[model samples]
Target: MIYVIIGILILAASFIWMEIAERRIQEWEKEK
Candidate 1:
């Protein structure tokens, strides 16, 4: 269960960061 929780946490962070990076890229594109 601990391993599962850890995996989920990592997966959530990966997705959240992916979204943040994507939005930042979009904003950068708009600035160009």
Candidate 2:
């Protein structure tokens, strides 16, 4: 059960990181 919880947290963090990276890329494109 503890391992399952850790897995879920990691998934959530990766998703959030991806979203932030996407937004940064969009902003960079707009500047160009």
Candidate 3:
């Protein structure tokens, strides 16, 4: 049960991280 909770948290964090990364990439492209 604990492992399942941890897995979910990790997945959520990674998803959020990816979103932030995508936004940053877009901003960078605009600057170019």
The candidate, 1 or 2, that scores higher on TM-score is 1
lDDT by residue (1-32, candidate 2, tens digit) is: 99999999999999999999999999999999
Summing lDDT over every window of 10 consecutive residues in candidate 2, give the lowest-scoring window: 1-10
TM-score of 3: 0.87
The runs of at least 3 residues in candidate 3 whose Cα sits more than 4 Å from the true structure, single-residue gaps closed, are: none
lDDT of 3 by residue, 1-32 (tens): 99999999999999999999999999999999
Tens digit of per-residue lDDT, candidate 1, span 1-32: 99999999999999999999999999999999
Tell me the spans in candidate 1 whose CA falls farther than 4 Å from its real position.
none
In model 3, what lDDT does residue 12 have? 100
lDDT of 1: 1.00
Candidate 1 residue-wise lDDT at 12: 100
**Structural similarity to truth (TM-score) of each candidate:** 0.87, 0.85, 0.87
